[model samples]
Target: MKHGLLWIARALGLFALCSWLTRRELRILCYHGIWDGPGHYGNYLFMSPGKFRSRLAFLQDWGARVLPLPVALERLAQGRLPARAVVITIDDGWASTVAHMVPALEQAGFPATLYVTSYYAHNQRPVLNVALAYALSRWAAGERDSTLLPLPGLGQLNCPAGDAIALHRATDQVIEHASTLADDDARQAFLCSVISATGLAQDPVWGGPAFRLASRDQLREASAKGIDLQLHTHRHRTTCNGTSCLAQELADNRSWLTGVGEGPFEHFCYPSGQYQASDWEVLRRQGIESATTTEIGLCRRGENPYALPRILDGESLSELELEAELSGFLTMLRRISRR
Candidate 1:
C-alpha cells in the first residue's frame, strides 16, 4: 500500500514540488563496483554493467540533474542547488571503473567520483572479500570427502571437504576469515591461496592481475577522460584501527592517490561504512571537504560534512524501490511513520 502510494505520488508530481522546495540540499547516490562478466555470484561489491546502465537511464528519464560530487557539495553550500540535483559516487576503485563503468557514465554524460582504497592499489592483490567469496563458491561447487576443513587464522570448520551441502555449512567461516586478516594485502594473499588450493579456476580471480585497485595507467587514463578518482583510504581502514593508525592510512592514501589522481583530493568515503565520531577531527585536520557514510538520509545544509549520509545503491534495491527512494517519498514516509 505504501509503495504504491509513493509511486503514485511521484507520478503525480508531488515529489517534484519537494525537490523544488528542498533545492538547498542534495541527493547523493552511492555505488560500489561494477562487474564486467558473470563470474561473480553473491558479490555485493557491485552490480552488473547492464544493470548500471539501466540505472543511469532511469535517473536521466526521471529528470535528475547529475553533478560531480565536489561540485554538488559546493553548490549546496552556496544554497544554489538545482532542483532534482543528484551526485554519483562509486566507492572502491575496482578495475571495472575503467573497463565497464566509465563508458556507461560517459554515455550518460554524468560526472562521477571513484574513491580508490590505496592498499590494493599499492600491493599486488585483489580485494579480500572477492577472494573469500570466490573460494567459498568454488568449494561449494565441487565434490569432496566428508571431513573437516581447516582455515588458517580463522580457525577450523567441520565442513565436508568434498560435499556442496556440507561446504554450504561453512559459509560464515569464510566471512570471518576475510575480516580477521592483518591488512588488505595479507587478506588478499590468504584468500587467493585458498581459491588456488581448491582448484577453483585455472586462471584465478580478476583474470589473475586484473583485480586490485585501478592501476596507475587506469587512474591516469580515467582522470584524462574526465572521471574523478578520489580517496577511500590507503587500506580501506576506518577509525577502528586506532587514531594514529587511521592518520597514517589517510596520509598514505593521500600521498599515493595524489600521485595518480588529478589535482587535490578533498572527499572521502568511510571504508565499508565503519567509523567513529572522533574521526571527524582527523578529517578536519586533513582538510577534507566532505565524507560520506553508509548511513541512510539526504544531505541537508549545516550537517557535519565529515559524517554525511548516503543511500547505498546495489542489486538488492530494485528499480521500483530505487524510484521510491529517489523520489524522496520514502524518506517522507519514514518521518511520518516514526511520528
Candidate 2:
C-alpha cells in the first residue's frame, strides 16, 4: 500500500511537471541486459525482453523520435533535434541483447549504441552483473556461512545474515582488493577467495548457470545491423580507484576496439560511471569524443560532452510508466532548476 501510494504521488507530480516543460528538450534512455525469465528482486539490473519491446512500441506509437546516439549528439551540437527526440543506448554487451533485443530493434527500425568491454568480448567471461546476482543469491540461500578470508588490500569479508551494512562494507573491501589485479586470472582468483571466505561457493545457485557475455560473432552481427559499438573499458574498472589505472583501461580499450575492427569508436561509457575530473582528462587524451555517466538528466547544447548524463532503465518500469517517465524528463529538469 505504501509503494502504491508513492507511485500515485509520483505520477501526479510527473503529470504536473509535464504540463510545464519547454517543449524542446531531448531524453536519452539507457539500458543494460534484457532477461526472458523470472528475475530476482533488487535485481533492477535486467529487464525482460518482452517488456523492452513493449516499451519501444509505446515510444514509437507516442510519436517519440528515436535517434541513434551519434545522431542525437550531432543534433544536440547543432540544436536541431525534434521536440520529442530521444536516443536509446544499451550498455554491457550481454548475450541476451543478441538473442532478444536485436530482433525487436530490427523490427522497430530503431538504431542504438552498444557499449562493450573488450576483455569480455575476447575472453567470454562473466560480467559484474552476473557476479553480483550470484553472490546475492548465495548469501540469501544460507549456502555461504561466516568464514575469515583475506582480501588483497583490505583484510577480510565476513558472511553473516542480518549484517547487511557490514557485508556491504566487506564487499567494498573485496572489490577494492580485486581492482588491483592486473589480469582476469588474478581478478578471478580474488573473486574466488572472496566467495570461499564468505562461504558462498556452497550455494547451489553458484554452481548453476552463470550469465554469459556476448561473443565476437554476436558483436559482429550487431555491428552489421547498424548498432554502434563503443568502448566500455577493457575490464569495466571503476574510476574512483586510481586515475592512472583508469587511463590505462581507456587506452587498452581503445587499442582493443580498434584491433577488433570495432572502431572508429569515438564514444565511451565509463565502467560503472564512476569517474573523476582526472578520469575525463584521461578519456580526452585517449581521443574519446564523448563519454556517458549514470547521472540522470537531459543533454543540452553547450553541456560538457565528456560527462554527459544518462537515465538508466530497468525492470521497474511498465510500458505506460516508461512512456510517462520519458515524457516527463524535460519537465523534471525544469522543475528541479526552478527549485
Candidate 3:
C-alpha cells in the first residue's frame, strides 16, 4: 500500500522537483559484497550482482553525476558540487567484490572506494563469526538436533535447534573459542568440526567465496583497475576501549593497505555503521579527512566530516524506491516528518 503511494509520487514528478532542490547536497551510496550464489543470505550485506547493475543503470538514467569520494568531499566543502553528485563506497572488501562488484563498476566506467578491513584480508580465511552464523542460519528448524554437540577444547554446546537466539548464542561461543586459536589452520579445523556437527559440511557456501574476504593479490589488482582502496580498520571493530585501541586499528589498517600501493588512506567508514561521540577526536588525531556512516541522508557542507551520511543500497529496494533516494524524495520526507 505504501509502495503504491511512492509510485504515485514518482509518477507525479515530485521526485524530480525534490532532486533539483537537493542538487547541492552530496549523495553517498554505500554497498557491501555481491553474492550470486544460492539461498537468501540477507539482502543488504550481500546484494545480487544483477540488482547492483540495475542500480547503476538507474543512476545513469536519473542523470546523476558519479564522483570519486575524496573529490566529491572536496568539491562539497568548497560549495562546488555538481548536480546530483554521488559517491560510491563499498565496505569490508568481501572476496566477491573483486569477482563481481569491480567488473560491474569497470563496465559502467564509474570509480568507487573500497573500505577494507585488514584482519581477514591479512589472514586469508573466512571470517569465523560470519561463517558460523551463516551455517547456523541455513540449518532447517526441524532438522536441528536438540542434543548438545560436544566440541573438544571448547566444551559442549546445548543449542536449542530451532531457536534463532539459541543458535546465535552457540555461534558466539564458537567464535569466542575460535578467536583464541593460534593460527588460521587451527581455526579452519575448528570451523570444519562445527560444520560437521551441524551436518552442513556439504553446503556450497563453505566452498564458495561467500564468507571470504578479498585476497591481497586481488586487492592490489582492484586498485590497479581504478578502485580507490581505503581504510575500514584492521579488525572491523569500533571500541569504547579508548583512543589508543582505535588508533592501532587505523595503523594496522594502513599497514596492510600500504601493500596495495594506494594511499594517503585518510578516508574511513565505521564498521557496521557503528560510532560514538568520542570517536570524533580519535579520527581527528589520526588525520582522517572524512568518515562515512550508514546513516541515510545526503551530505552537506559544514556537517561533521566524521559522521557524514550515506544511503545503503540493498537487494530488497525496488527501482522506484532507489529512485526516491537518488532523487532526494526520501530525504525531504524525513525532514518534513521531523518538523
Candidate 4:
C-alpha cells in the first residue's frame, strides 16, 4: 500500500511538472557511485548503471540540452539557459564511475563533472562502516563464518556469523552516531566505546576485508578522459566544531588536490550534503566559485552560485520521475515567485 501511494504521488508530480515547465531552465542532476550490482555496504547509496543510462536517454528524448559544467554555470549566471538545459554531476571518484558510467556519458555526448574525495584519491580504504555493512550482509546470508579484525583501542575482535541483518543494523546505528562526532578524536573514542560495549570482537562479521578507495592513477586516467575533477573534502569531513578546524579541513583538501596535480579545482561538493554558513565563507575565501548542496531545487539565474542545488539521482527515480525532476525547476520558480 505504501508503494502504491508512492506511485500515485509520482504520477501526480509528473503531471504538475509538465504543466509547469514550459521554458528552458538549468537542471543539475547529482549522482554518487554507479555500480552494476548494488554495493554490499549500502545499496541505497549506489545506482545501477542500467537505470543511469535510461535516465540519460529520458532527458535526451525530452528535449533537454546536456551541457558541460562550466558552460552550465555560465549560462546559469547570465540567466540565459536554453529551454530544457541540464547538467550531470557525479560525486565520489568511484571506480565504477570510470568503468561504467563514463562510457555511457561519452556515448550520449553528455558532459559531466565528477567530484573526487582527496583522501580517496590517495588510496585510503573506505571507513569501517562500509566494511561492516558488507560483512554483515554476507554473514546474514550464511555465506561466511568467522572473521578477524582489530578495533581501535580494543585491539582485535572476532565477529560472529549469525543473525547478519540484525548485527548490520546495530553496527549501522553505531557508525551513524559516531559520524556525529565533531573530530577524529571524538569519533575514535565513540567507536572504541561501541566496540567495547558490543563485544563484537568475537563476532565473525567484524573481521571482513576493508573497502578500497580510488587511487591517484585512476583519478588521472579519469581526468585524461575529460572528466572534470572537483573537491569533495579530505577525509569526507562534513562538520567541525569551530572555524579553525573548518579552515584546516579546507586547507588540507586544497593542499592534497594541488599536490596531486588534480586541481585548479573551483567546484566543491558538501560532504554528505552537510555544510554550515561558515563552510560557505571558507569556500569563498579559498577561491571556490561554486559549491553544491544536497538541497532539492533547480539552478536559476539569480540564485547564489555558491550554494547551488542538485537533484539526487538514484534507483528510486524512474524515467517519469526523472522528467519530474527536470521540470521541477519550473514548479519551484512558480511557487517562489507566487506565479
Which has the greatest TM-score? Answer: 3
In order, what lDDT does every prediction score? Answer: 0.75, 0.70, 0.87, 0.66
Predicted candidate 1 versus true structure: per-residue lDDT over 1-339, tens digit per residue:
867876788789877766565566688888877765446544357688788899999999989899998888888888888877899888888877778888889889999988888777666566666666656766656576634446666555666545566665576667666677787567667776676656665644447434566787787788888888887888778655344466777888889877687868888888888878788898888888889998876788777898887767887677877776676666666667989
Candidate 4 residues 19-91, lDDT tens each? 3563445788898876444243344367777777887788788777888788888877776778778888888
lDDT of 2 at 226: 78
The better candidate by TM-score, 2 or 4, is 2
Instruction: Give the poorly placed runs of model 1, Cα more than 4 Å off.
Output: 1-21, 39-44, 141-156, 159-189, 196-199, 202-210, 240-244
Residue 283 in model 4: lDDT = 77
Error of 1 at 240 (Å): 6.1
Residue 248's C-alpha lDDT in candidate 4? 62
Model 3: lDDT of residue 48: 87
Tens-digit lDDT string for candidate 3 (1-339): 878989999899999899899999999999999886786676888898888898888888878799999999999999999999999999999999999999999999999999999999888888888887776566534364454767767677776766677777877887889878998798889888878877887777878878889989999999999999999999998764444477888988998899794788999999899898888898999999999999999988887999999998888988888888888999999999999
- Which candidate wins on lDDT? 3
Return the lDDT, model 2, position 212.
61
